[model samples]
Every structure is written in C-alpha cells, then in structure tokens.
Target: MTTFLLFSFLQLAQPSAIQFTNQDLQLESNSGYIQLDWTAVEGSQYILQRSMQPDFTNSHTIYQGPDHASFVSGLDNGTYYYRVGDDEGHWSDTLTLKVEHQSMPLALTLFGLGFVVFAFTVFVVIKGVYTTSQS
Candidate 1:
C-alpha cells in the first residue's frame, strides 16, 4: 500500500543524532506539576521516556514528537529519570529529576504582586509619553 511505502521511506530518512540544549526542569506547586523544557532539535522528532526507578526497567513513554519538550503533570514527590531520543534510536544524555512540594510564602507572593503592579505602571507611563510625543 502507498501508506506502507511512505512509512518505510520516513523510517529510512530518520536522523541518527539529536542534540538538545537549554534543558530545564522544574516542579510547580509542591510536586504537583513537572515541567520539562529543552532546546528544539534541528531536524528530528523526540521520544520522551520516564521511569520511577533509576534502572528504568519500568519505563513508560510520556510523549513523542518534534516539539523537543514535554510536561509530566501530577507526579508526586519523588525521583524520576528521563531521556529524549530520535526516531533512528539515537538518544541524548539521560537526566534525573526530583520533585518536591513547596508552600508559597505569603511574603514572597506579596512581593511578586507588587512587582507586577510596578511593571504595569511603568508600561502605562511609557505609553502615555509615546502618545503625547506622537500628537
């Protein structure tokens, strides 16, 4: 079938190497969310794998795509291993991460809100100046 031939061709065309940059990992809201990000690969798809054990015998796929990153949500406080690979079976270096629950300190939250207000005020002032100059 035509679909079969196309699939074969794509398999052959898959690259052997996929490099990732700008790798970032974060846990939001006390291990409630696991957000993973990486630099996009130039010409390859990504297969994201995860395992609870370091040995990875119980690994499971989190995603597969060319997007180069994924977020694994609803993970409890624990350690996890991750890796990204190309369709050709070439894999980048492995990464290990731990998610920990964190409570938002009231002081920090207030400070962040203050910063947002200050930024909005500055933006309004700049916009007013620009409009006046244009007129």
Candidate 2:
C-alpha cells in the first residue's frame, strides 16, 4: 500500500507537458506577424518565450499571462524560435518560423504600376466629361 501511494504521489507532483496546438510548427511567413498558440490548463498561467537560437540559448520571455494565444507583430526578416511553458516551468518543444518579406524593389514596382493606372483612369474620365458637355 505504501509503495502504491508513493508512486501515485510522484505522478501527481510531476509537471504536465506543454504542447503547441500547431502540429506543423515549422513554417515560413511572408507577413510581419504571427499568432502563437498552445494548449492551456485551466486556472494556470503560461509563459511564452522567444529566441534566435533553436537550442533556446539566451531566450527571453515574450509573454506571461493566462492567454493561450499571442499575436506577435513587426518582426524583422529572420529565423525565430518559440516555446510555451506553464507556470511550473515545464516547457514545450520549440517551433521554428522563417520570415522573408517581399523585396523592396518589387514593392516599389507595384506602387509605380498602381500610380500609372490611377493617372490613366483620371485622364479618361475628364476627357469623357468634356466631350459630353461640349456636344
């Protein structure tokens, strides 16, 4: 009876695993933001950590609250590592994210094309109104 009780007590004392809800965690994003989510335990707050290294060296806590999801934005283009942990210090497996935004030249070209289209549309509208009123 004592052995059984001891084993049960040990089991209860051990921390539960923190698992990320996103199974396909390795992904790339062209956007500047991402939503990080994980499984949450009722009545327990969680800690969200981010690091540049996959090994979690020099990791810093990005969030610590009861919320299970975090919206992270304005991230520069690079590789990022994230992990979620419970208040008891049980950490989940790391997730890797790669951010590669569109090139500046491409963005500028799109803008110029848009401006040209706008100018052409305005010229056509003005010419049509002038011809109708003159006739």
Candidate 3:
C-alpha cells in the first residue's frame, strides 16, 4: 500500500519546464582560462558551478545569469568540471573543460628552433676544444 502511494505521488509531481542542453566546454586562447556554455533554458536564469576534482570535493560557483554566455578566467592548466542549473531547479550534466597556459605561437616556435641550433653549435664547439686540449 505504501509503495503504491509513493508511485502515485511521483506521477503527480511535475518535471522542470526549463531544460538545459548542448553543453560546450572550451579553453580561452593562450590563457589558462576556461569557458562553459550551454543551450539557453527558457524562462530561467543560469547558475554555473565549477570543480577541480572529478568527485567535486571542492566546488565553486562561477556565475549566475540569464545570458547565453559565461567566461571563467584564471583557471589552472588542466581539466575542470562544470555544471549548470536553472532557476526552475533543473540541473544539467557536468561538462569538462581543458585549459592550456602556453599555446605555441609561430614566432615562439621559430625562437625555440633558433635556440636549439645555438645550443647545438655551442656544444659542438666545447666538444672540439676539449678534444684538442686532450690531443
């Protein structure tokens, strides 16, 4: 009798009208920042939260807004988990974002190549000098 009553109550409850979808997580340029976004929920305000660990041992609220976009800055260079909740108590599935502090620019790549060549030349010169001294 109790089980039937519980089932009937569950059926009577209405689901959340505000639905979240199309969650996207991405990095912001070369900075160690992450951006969490999702499909706009109708008639609701978005609440964004982030966590450093998979289990969400430490969670932080990043944003609360009705806008379609949100940006989170000063993130670590690793993976982060985020979730969105609407004002109507509808929460979304967690999204994962990856942030990279250093992106290899063309100029930086060329500079690195130049430094490698210079280092090799210096090493070769030192080796030659040592060999001559030994002889």
Candidate 4:
C-alpha cells in the first residue's frame, strides 16, 4: 500500500522549466579573446552562433555540444553578435560583443616608458657602486 501511494505522488509532480541564468548570458571580453558562458541544462546540447551583422544573415555556428562556455580568439576589432540555442530550438536573447585591439602607437609608447625606467635603474645602481668603492 505504501509503495502505491509514493508512485502516485511522484507521477503527479511536474518538472520545472529549464532556463539559462541571466547573469551567465552576458558576454565577457579580454585582451585577446571573447568568451560566452552560460548555465547548461542536463541532456541538452547548446548551439552558439556569431556574425558581424546584427541581422545574423551570415551567422555561422561556432559550437554545437554540451559545453557551458565558448571562447573565440584572433578576431579583428569590430562589433559582433551572438546567440545561443538548444537542440529543442529554444534560443536565448541576442547579445553584443565589442572588441578593440591595441594600436601600434600605444604599444610603442609603453615600450618607450619601460626602457626609460630600466635605464634609470641601471644608472642608480652604478652610482651607488662607485661611491661605495671610493669610500
């Protein structure tokens, strides 16, 4: 009698809807890469697509598996659009990612600053050594 009651209750329960976390749907940008992370549902495969245009007419699938995150690198500086979907055809809202690579002028300025600091440090060390020897 107890086994029968437990089975009846289990069957009456409804499973909750599967959805991705809002926070996890955001796009993350780094120096040389862009990453998309999301909460994955069990037994469901996700499809990730990207395109340079907002209409996604030329979008291409970058990943189609059961992974929780995707990464893209070596992309030129520009705006990109991304969207994620499940095998069931349920797609999340579109998100935008912007990439800005470092320019050559900025790189040269940083290199010049580093060289100046290094030269000053060497000069300070040599002056201290000469003074100690004379004393």
lDDT of 2 by residue, 27-100 (tens): 78898789888988788899999999999999999999999999999989999999999877888988899999
TM-score of every model?
A: 0.53, 0.83, 0.52, 0.67
Write candidate 3's Cα lDDT for 1-135 as tens digits: 999999889875865433334434443345765445577845668888788886667888778888756767777677887777787667766677776666558769989999999999999999999999999
What local lDDT does model 2 show for residue 113? 100
Best by TM-score: 2
User: What's the residue-level lDDT of 117 in candidate 3?
Assistant: 100
The lDDT for every candidate, in the order shown, is 0.73, 0.91, 0.71, 0.77
Task: Looking at model 3, report the run of 10 residues with the lowest lDDT sum.
Answer: 19-28
Q: Point out where model 3 deviates above 4 Å.
A: 1-30, 103-135
Give the Cα-based TM-score of candidate 2 against the true structure.
Answer: 0.83
* lDDT tens digits by residue: candidate 4, 1-135: 999989888865633233435464445454657667766767778888898888899999999999968877887777888888888776767777777778889999999999999999999999999999999
Clashing pairs in 3: none
Worst 10-residue lDDT window for candidate 2 reads 14-23
What C-alpha lDDT does candidate 1 achieve relative to the native structure? Answer: 0.73
Off by over 4 Å in 2: 1-14
